[model samples]
Target: MTDIIETYLEDFGPALSGTISEHLEKSLGISAAAARKRVSRASGNIRRLGYVTFARKARFMYLENQFGSPLYWRKLVDALFSTNSAYGYAIAALIQREGFVPEWEFPIVCGAPIKQSRHLSPATIMQRLKEAGLLQTIQVNGLGDCICIVQSEEHYNSLAADTRVRLITENILLLAVKDWLRKLGIVSFDKVTIRSSTHAPKVGTFVWDLTAPSYLGCLIKTGKDKKVKPGFVAADVYLGDTITEPGSRPFINKCKTLRALRNVGPCMQIFIANRYEKEAFSLLKQNGIMPATPESLFGEDVAKGLSELTSVLHDAASHSLDPERFERLFAALGKIEGAANQLRGTLFEYIAAEVARKNYSSLVRMNQIYKNQSGKKAEADVVIITDNISVRFIECKGYSPRGIIPDTEVRRWLQHNVPVIYKAVKVHPDWQNLDIKFEFWTTGILSDEAIAMIKTAQVSTKATRYSLGFKLNQDVYDLCKSTKDKGLITAFEKHYLPPY
Candidate 1:
């Protein structure tokens, strides 16, 4: 019984009294009263179950050893995330890592489009987190309202101020680089994998302060005349005032890793810091890494703005507010927020692209926009042209592995996007002779009604000019692993795989 309860707590994270009884009754096929009694016994036995009481009424159940360790909060938050939706985990991870997030920007950071709502609204996510005792909404001195982790004052301040500043500075640098890439019009994959400081840096790995994979040329162009090359641009940011030779060991080692990966493609590696010693800069330059300052990468004005903004935001998170400084920082706020939002909400599209790139050596495009005669436009998340004889249009949905894709979305895809793209392709001079295959791909399940809608469309279109199909989480995983690319597999596991 103890082992069973321990396993349950480990898998589900800390649970309240009522939730514990509910799970026990279901798992053991026992009465509610019996389950409650068992919980009472185990919770009392300090040798087995560790329980914490909040407000003298709400009890949280967990393994005894994890209650107050340094990793306690991270583990608990992660466990809770595992049981929730993908968006839930994404939002939680972002907030917990940052330690403080502004209330207004929370939605945007969670991939919500400007002036539009995602499948899960920001308010709903916040409420859920509050109910789980993971976060709270509070007013900062000048930031209005901010969302922060729920912990004692001591635990919250235990993280060194320098470490906190470093985390925030790195995040700022990543956003600045992303904005720079977007301005250059070469951001192939909108989603970026930002580094987290929760663990020691791994050598010989692709993880960096910022990673954005982009194409060098136009993606919309077709036929034999068009040339598009794919590569990844990665950067590492140092927060210290200046990097001396001895202090540059970590960055130098990371540059070595990036050099080793150059054979993978034409990747651009950047080392960003406030300043670098002459010898250190020379070493980085000799390593084929672009050693730059925030001012050099982004103009001096923008760099100064970012530096001030980072300082102000860190101060705000630490309960020090400067309304005047915070207000002045808004000059560059729009671009930064847009860049961060762009870096999210498209994980699945990139995943689908990987599957196609591995399966076909022909022309593959992402975020392709097509127009009809009347100038109406539609965008396909991913497009692949194989042998110049078959064209595949893939629509990707980045939903939670445990969530369901809505029937309305499915209906719209089948009724609107498919027919429009099919007509557009059939009339295009470049694709006149190619067969069409339209596939709906998602990292989630489809309800029975939604499946029926898709199946009906599939059969009705069977004899038509284009074929229709779909790929769920398991289907995607099977195809991703089939590619035998370790990077692709790791991405699938991180973004698409079910926690269980």
Candidate 2:
């Protein structure tokens, strides 16, 4: 009976479970329940051999050997297109052309909000397609909700996490540039249109990071006759650590395409990043690409803020993430966008992780989320742990070099974050028989009250499972110097060290 069911299913690709069962019952003259049992058994066997299932209108077809197949996703998307051309094409264009589109903007891309009252609204169309498992929405940090195509759990997970982070990072840079442009009186926010991958036209075959059209010249405008200028402005941004030899050729090629497009009219081409190789820099200047850094473009303060935010975000992309915390981090990121000062604390966390890596010989993780048996959740900034040996949790405060650590901040770390983390560590099986250390590292002076609180907390925890310690600005600098890592030393001096 199972062999018969498998043979029947092999002939039909991706049929609903009920449809398969109904066919079995009618063809074999068996009861519905008996037929369903045989169908279930057959599917379970196929699933073990690289097949996958989905739930749409019902338990969707179990595809044979689709699980580990390189061509499976394309086949699945093609099937979706066969079912509904409009929604299918939208999904394909979003993934292939644009990469990903925020949900709100997606409707506009699809030529939505049709005028006639008789037809279904654009929102309704999207909602219906989502209900049918043709579309999926993943909430990105800072960027809000974004659209991707997937009908099953496996496919969703396969979409890389760094890809989403990269999208959010790019959008943040664009927003910053837009704000900077507005402040300079070059253009108002309303006049400027921030283009996305699919929304913006490609220059040759390259999709630019920034694309805008000019309404008037930078320094000239006729009051009586307002003539629209025929010109283009575009920028390409590199977010990698540094643009080196291997990566330089492709970038230069793309810049050449933009240069060729200049024949249509006057065009402004810009390149933005923190660091570039000497050769890459020369090539950019030779090709007429204006090379700009955050500091060069937006000044020292804004540049420092952008550098801190991107640094923390790059580190965050590697950790095992909790959905709630991920959302919070992104929300915090949005806040940091407006006020660069907000990134100091999060930025310090990454710096502290680097210090922990230099001092301790163990597995070090940042922004680790933990939950105890009673469902109490806690987060650790930097945790260094080796099974059955030791666990160190470090909380960081990234205030100004001469700033004072608040008494309330000290009180909470001792009173709240410490207790929760202790309980969380106790519940972990591998953390058994380990000595624990809890430390506060800050690039600021401690107030007298805050110092007393730390001393008291240390005395109280002396007999306990964990020990307590604190490192001020000078102490942190000394530890960093001990590491003898030139890059680490330079970063610490720039961000944390004080001038005498």
Candidate 3:
């Protein structure tokens, strides 16, 4: 009976109407009217047995038995609901090729685009899944517009724990890199771009995660002819609290990733978040991997110089009208010996702050770190508090050669950082009532798509409370050009201001 039903369905495809009866009659050597009765009986039996479903109104057959389990159905739903047909097929193929596990661990599987025909947004995909009894979505605050999908309530709790650990560990890795760069006199928060493969464009890019043969680091170097030469660096960032066992599956996967990265380049470093992960360190060392803590990245003199430089900047922020202190700080930064690019980033932040202080009524604070009630912290590059109690939270990005900021970076700031700022404002007693605004101040050209996304995000419920502004390359140049200080203007033009 199952074979006959399967054969009939296979001949006519998932949806059957007159074609099923016509094919059955020809194949079974039966009269057309008799074959029609058999078709009805077979469909009824299949539906009663709960192996397949027949939609009466739609007159379509759906093979529910093809999906072995709810997990399998979930995978099919993910593929069917992808952004476009091609992208959907690609995701489905990837799942098939990679063998979907309960804990898939791929970033693309969670946040990839949904089919346009369904008119579903990423935020609403889980609701549709829940209606189908495939998955449930759980809202998690402070995680910034995230969705958690699970097969069951018990699975949701287990996955949520894993997700939180992953997020915290990733955040630690980002903060650690920023701290290391700051200690080395690199101050621009946008110098390093952290992106997952799921967010990358579809063409010529492979999915990358903590356990992938991804382009972990690509540092651009100026050749002898002054042309740009890109160099790849292999680095593994691991937080001890997240991955405790040196012999665990995750650790093994990371080792495999590192091996693949090493095949492409010889220069590699292992960055451990906790110094007490001695077993992990030993494992790396045994495998000939060089491990370094953030503190050990710089010399004592360089560390001391950075400390003094921080003090000078703080003094300038506090005493913006003090020309002598400003000059001294600028001169010290110029004289400090290090990577030119790193110094350029540091100079960009300071000049941005200086420009803001000169133009605004007063600098309430610059480079201040704020934490929300949920304990999510964000550092604002510059904050201007007007006489009317209006506050501006500015984000500065220094991308040299212009027009290099990708759409992913713009989306990251909007979807993630904007919420952080919103929450920070909500929790602060003094700033809660003030008219707040956000400005993306960059020395790089903004793409039209990025600008549009920003405009849309500004009015979105996630950021509707604050007004949005943009300060692009041209704006920065104009702001710097207005200053009468020739030396300061020249320095700004050379480092922070982009050419026309």
Candidate 4:
């Protein structure tokens, strides 16, 4: 595995070296020889272990498998800039700290301090940490950040007694449910929000509310002006696997927590691993609560995607030392990740092809970037032609986890370039007289404001005789799952979905 990854990195070494040298000269005023020496060491470390070994004696037996994959290693290397080994050492010390309490702040799991000086800035270091996936930024009432070191499911499950870790797990499950709901055509569904118990009791730990408006009864005196209420739905997710038996202190406390949540009108959900399912369910049932697996909440299609993702990860980790296995696993990862839109373009292409398979004969062309006679350049992510001579053009955007597709970007694309692109395609002699349709696809949640802008844009575009439509993260996932491909279904059942 190390050899395979080394070969992969060899293709990028010159680029990496150039980046490191420039950062060192600009950030630290380092000499060229010193920078080259540092780069050499970093490169050697990556080639040997696929990650930096910060601690001289500390062992990472549990994390060995994670280092097997080139992607994970690339993330680590990318996290460290030239002459920033101190930041790496600081992270290592934090990981080594005993009885670590997770916190949502810079220097999240503090142990040995990374000295603050003119040469090293916390802001830049923190940003690098986030880019490396060693940290994650989240929004609650305000922006907050937290450590995100566990790269795989196996590593996450190995942690003990960390409420924050448990919360992260629960949030992932909730996100899956939110995605599933979206796929089911619930466009009004809002993204789930995570709130700490310390902040607000009414909000619970996780909340999902729809934004559609509802009419309420009119005021008593006038009985004319009707009150308006916003649509809302909430769920309180409890990680209950740690409870050993019923009637115990922890079990009772959890029940009390659920009772409190019920008083606040949100449904209660408990997630337990299979090992503790019988006992956990018995205790919850006695309290009028039923425990649910992640699969049961999100359904089979989601389970399959989740399973395929993890299986690829686990396979890469388990075979990190074998070149043959590494190559095979790398190829598999590419296919899964490609279909999953790791490269951003694949997600759009996959959706376009799938839609064509269902309705059109086949995809005509993908990733067509063109300039009109007016010199306006516009790129369509995908293009397809149906048997009836209908032509479809798609634009795709892939956003990271917890990211939002903003209204401003969508507005610019819809108002400025889309019209010109339509004109350019219409002028093509071969495409003349063909009906044209436009679609926008994104793997991120679209804000209500953005959706409103899209709708308004759709109205204007329709006036020009072009049809326009949009699909967000949930829509894409639902469409893929509905295909019911046998291999995907098996992967989901065997790997992704929780064992019932």
Off by over 4 Å in 2: 1-59, 67-347, 386-388, 404-408
User: What TM-score, over all chains together, does every model reach?
Assistant: 0.35, 0.48, 0.38, 0.31
Candidate 1 contains a number of clashing pairs equal to: 0
**What is the Cα-based lDDT of residue 417 in candidate 1?**
84
Better of 2 and 4 by TM-score: 2
lDDT of each: 0.61, 0.59, 0.48, 0.44
Candidate 3 on 1-500: residue-level lDDT in tens?
34676665544334343455667677788897786676666643243212212334112333455333434434343424332322222223223212222222233233233333333333353444445443333332212223333334444443333343343333334434444544554333334433341242121112222221122234344556976543332344433232222212222233344345422332233443335346756666766555654346544443343344444544443443343443454444333323334445545676777777767755455555565668665667677888557888888787664547787877877777767887888777677778888888887767899999988866664443887778887787778777665645766666554456
Largest lDDT belongs to which candidate? 1
| Sort order, TM-score high to low | 2, 3, 1, 4
Cα RMSD of all models vs. native, in order, equals: 23.5, 13.9, 17.6, 18.8
User: For residues 241-343, what per-residue lDDT tens digits would candidate 2 score against the true structure?
Assistant: 5654323433454455444543344566677777778986887788777877877876775565555555556654443212233334444444434433334
As a TM-score, model 1 comes out at 0.35
- The C-alpha local distance difference test score for the whole of candidate 4 amounts to 0.44
Q: In model 3, which runs have C-alpha deviations exceeding 4 angstroms?
A: 1-338, 401-403, 459-464, 498-500
Model 1 worst lDDT run, 10 consecutive residues = 109-118
Between prediction 2 and prediction 3, the one with superior TM-score is 2
lDDT of 4 at 181: 45
Cα lDDT tens digits for candidate 1, 86-106 = 333433434433455445445
Instruction: Please say which candidate is ahead in lDDT: 1 or 4.
Output: 1
